[model samples]
Target: MATTTDKVLNRKIVEKARKMKSYAYASDDPEISDFSHPSVINIADTVQVGISTGGSSPAMARKIKIKTESFLKKNISSEDIYQIKLQKFARIEAKQVLSTQLDRKKFLYGVMNDKRVKGLLKEGKYKMAQGRVKKMLRKLT
Candidate 1:
């Protein structure tokens, strides 16, 4: 149970361990195992969203992480992840302010459709987009 410098072998070892229901942590060196190590990517997040693809198809999982990193970026460029972040922030802020469930849902869904917000996002003016979104969210608070 020594850590192998070979990445492919490490992945295989991790995969095997995953089948044991001791699934979450993969030890590099069992003798001095440190399962508490932080993974660069959040496996829980991907799993919750079905991104791990687990045994379904790792290649597909890789493609999902590689291809569309930005929200709905399968239709856009990879560099557009920033806009997605802005949108996510806007959504969380809106949710915090809007009280009624229906109103919050509608506002969040329509945020992207608003001409000002959309235009700001399209222009990559994240600051302006955030400001605009905050102003809008304040109205519902």
Candidate 2:
């Protein structure tokens, strides 16, 4: 009763289902079709072992604590953690550079109008500005 296109599509779906079934269970297990139930248990066991082994470093622990505290304070989820880390680092670095009085007007103007400096800043090359700024600041001071 099916058309040629319908038959072809049905055949493709059957083949995909067969492949999925085969992949979901070991060759020796004929009764098991889904591994999700066992996979969850395995995941719990792995997490328990990892926690018991003290697998994290001090630096990693500190970073995690700081991230957790910041997330609690700001109501951020884990998905946004990397962006938060980058923003925090950038803010600290910018504050340090600004504290040094490295020609704020020139730097801002250059960043706004100069293609090369803007490109470098966009690429997060603050160190490149450090030496140049130091020299210019020395001249001004």
Candidate 3:
């Protein structure tokens, strides 16, 4: 088997790892991060927001990772996935509705920051948030 170091440093592997890390960082799936730290946090599947110093400062990375985990636990809800999904669906839907790149960008921005959606997300009401997003999309289109 390829050693952990070998796997992480290879360019293609790094790219794949980064994508996997992004998902773990964003999920509430309950898993450990791929860090070499002794005290790894099994925080989204939700911790470490993909902060790497490219082999320069592992300690700093861990510090930031732990801090982020704490911050999320304090401020962000693990189930607040509505915004993430909305962005994805909206991007595809916007292509059908929006005629210009600028219009799509503006529409996405408005959807991202809508307070009602944020409130729904924080409360873990993803279905309600999705419903609101569909309404928003309809209104905008």
Best by TM-score: 3
Q: What is the lDDT of residue 118 in candidate 3?
A: 82
Ranking by TM-score: 3, 1, 2
Q: How do the residues 1-141 of candidate 2 rate in per-residue lDDT, one tens digit apiece?
A: 111345455445444667766434222222332321111111212221111113224345445555555445455433233333333444444454566545554544443354543454556665664444344435544
Clash count per candidate: 0, 0, 3
Error of 1 at 114 (Å): 0.9
The runs of at least 3 residues in candidate 3 whose Cα sits more than 4 Å from the true structure, single-residue gaps closed, are 1-48, 78-80
Evaluate residue 93 in candidate 3 and report its C-alpha lDDT on the 0 to 100 scale: 83
**Ten-residue stretch with the least lDDT total in model 2:** 44-53
Candidate 1 vs candidate 2, lDDT winner: 1
Give per-model TM-scores. Answer: 0.49, 0.20, 0.53
- Indicate the residue-level lDDT of 87 in model 3: 81
Candidate 3's residue-wise lDDT over 28-137, tens digit each? Answer: 11123343323345445434356655445567777877887677667645544456666877788889988999999998898788898888878888788778877887
Candidate 3: the clashing residue pairs are: 30-45, 31-45, 43-46
The reply for model 1, stretches above 4 Å from the true place, is: 1-21, 24-74, 78-80
* Model 1, residue 109: C-alpha shift (Å): 1.7
Superposition TM-score, candidate 1 onto the true structure: 0.49
Q: Which candidate would rank higher by lDDT, 2 or 3?
A: 3
Please estimate how well model 2 matches the true structure, expressed as its whole-model Cα lDDT. 0.40
Ranking by lDDT: 3, 1, 2
Inter-residue clash pairs, candidate 2: none
